[model samples]
Target: MTDTTEPTALLTAIDLTARDARVRKRHRAELRFRGYGIFSIGVAVAALLWLFTSLAVGGAGAVYTTYIKIDVHLDQTVIDPDATGDAAVFAKASYQSLIRSGLRNHFPGVTGRRDQRALNGLVTLAAPYLLRDIVLDDPALIGTKTGIWILASDEADLIARGKGTKRSTKSRNDGQAAWIAELRSQDRVERRFNWQFFTGGDSREPELAGILVAMIGSVLSLLVCFAVAFPVGVLAAVYLQEFARRTWITTLFEVNINNLAAVPSIIFGLLGLYIFLNVLHLPRSAPLVGGLVLALMTLPTIIIASRAALQSVPESIRDGALAVGASRVQAIFHHVVPIALPGMMTGTILGMARALGETAPLLMIGMVAFIVDVPKSILDPATALPVQIFLWADSPERAFVDKTSAAILVLLGFMVLMNAGAVLIRNRFEVRL
Candidate 1:
């Protein structure tokens, strides 16, 4: 038509081989895509490192407490008041005076009620509780001079933890400040592992607070959630995927399950509030109620995951079992379900992990209450770890800041353990068929 020979020559001049312009352009584009993927991975790793570093830096020091060893001279007149070891008399004694006397002996130059009060501020109020325990354990100690390790108050402990010098103003006045400085200079203060943080329950005093109760509550709630959700969810999934017919009702149910899975978690909380608390009249702040609420939230996840796993199993496996004269239920239970078991279990644990981290649903059922006593039963009033973290984070105390960070680290560690368990199950037991 128009210069066909010349046009063909021009087209041939541009080679379509690996060295062609189009091929080189595509190679460059592929390199850019690979670079983007590597960069994304690096960013994710950096973010995780940043998060863990921040938490560790903030909470590591809080795992231990600073103490001052004071020689307390227990006076029989002040403690026993008589030659009798009556329990009531021992309880009524002023251990605070004994501790104050110890502090006074440590620094005799400080006098007057104001200076004494300032000096007394250096030790926590819980120090008296320690002394009381010692005296009650052995009544003979009431009249002896003993060197007891007493927990320093939060301010002094902060200073001992190398938070600052006397100029940091953690003290009430220059006298107490100078006294604390003198103690630090003389190495009277020491830091030790805070076992109380694990053994004690929640307290208004941050130094006396612990997450034991909350940890127990979380365990109890998750136990109930697992007991109720696992069997029901798997059975429901099996019926829907393997046994149920493709009817309008089944389709509606499937659609509703999907919709429920997408619903906001707070809606489930409200549902729990109304159905469990209002209608059934279950005890408020009980782990049982929290677990039931979490069961509802976890159901759709387990069911969906189980169904997907079941669907992944080849139809030939069921057909082969049927050919061997086995019933449909037998084939499913013996052959198919076992293959899908690991996946279903992983899904269940993941769902439980999600439940463990949830606070809003627990809050709706009154699990956000400030409980100091450890719950002895599922029906007892309690708070979960997330709720405890929330409460601590809301407190204005500087000590709670580190405690909150420590709690968050604990929660993260638990979540990682759960996910690792899921991975282990998947890797060890997952059936290829």
Candidate 2:
């Protein structure tokens, strides 16, 4: 063997040099990882921005429509003399036939059945109903003419409202410009504001379809969701975090809540259908039933989030309340809950946003397929906005494509407003401690 001192010195120097090299390598690697992380975040932000811009550009044209003022003349020639003896004389075929003939007179330049129907399609369904009412109410106007500028279809409204060919540009992506040109030749396609989107029902015609029914459905269902989910989820979370004793029993439930949060929403929907519709026999396809299903799916989310919020409250605050002679319940209710509310609201709002966009479970609950008048109550058959969009998106009609995007825009607006309100409430009421 070599001299002991020489071997020891050589080994020690080599070990020191190798250790220094490893330390330097690790430091360089850490910097590279950090740089890559920042770069990935930046790319993700840019991609999201691009996506939002595209959707906004495509969706903004869905809310307004075009219109033309026509001076419609009413006279004895249009209203039958003998029909006046009937209580529902206004519903006579003579009056309808004459009025149809007169409208045909106005667009004399159009002759083909397709062309005339296309122009007539520009006229909204509500327009003729409103006109009929006006004539029936004022019998004195029977010999006179009145001016009317009724709202038109969304495509025509865009043009009449000066939205200028957004669909025309969009169609360029699919080589549909030729068909759009044919529609233009037939005088059926134009950029127009879609007022009906806010006032109409789930029409087979996109121009007649609106968000009103879906809005009502969303409002009623969300009411049900909040009424049922908020109290239950909060209480469950409070019990888990504050009052439950340490045991395998409590631990099992704690794990179960987390697992529930990850379960698929549609599965909850099926459970709701079986329990609420099949067994309980609640009203089928009602907003109440849909809300109940959504509530079940959302409960785990709200409970998990609320529990995190409660955990975030400092232990010192709880101790202080107890030291001041407050009971456990009082301390938790007055101090801990108040402090945790902002975070709780934030979490609950996010979960609600998720719930609002859900359509599958709603589909199972009968919100998937419908084309009826708005319901008078929660028990009425109704469709939520996402489900409405889903139905239209599946339609073969070309116009339904834009209508789907428009409904999505409205749904998106509601979600943004809800989240914004949560932010405002947090800023206004949340305590720093």
TM-score of each: 0.91, 0.78
> Which one is best on TM-score?
1
**What digit string (tens of lDDT, one per residue) describes model 2 on residues 1-433?**
5687898988999999999999999999999999999999999999978867766665665554445454566655556465463336654424434344555666666567766555554456566665667667766666567655555544455444334443444433222223334444656444455566777778765567777888889888988998899889998988899999989999999899889889888899999999999999998878999889988988988888889999999999999999999999999999998898887888788888889999989988888756468878999888898898888889775556667777887898899999998889789988986
- Name the regions of candidate 2 deviating beyond 4 angstroms: 1-42, 68-75, 83-88, 91-96, 106-127, 137-140, 145-147, 150-193
**Tens-digit lDDT track of model 1 for 96-199:** 99998999999999777877777887888788888888888888787889888789877677656656433234445456557767887877778898887777
Clashes of each: 0, 18
User: Cα RMSD (Å) per model?
Assistant: 3.6, 6.5
lDDT of 2: 0.75
Give lDDT: candidate 1, residue 181.
Answer: 77
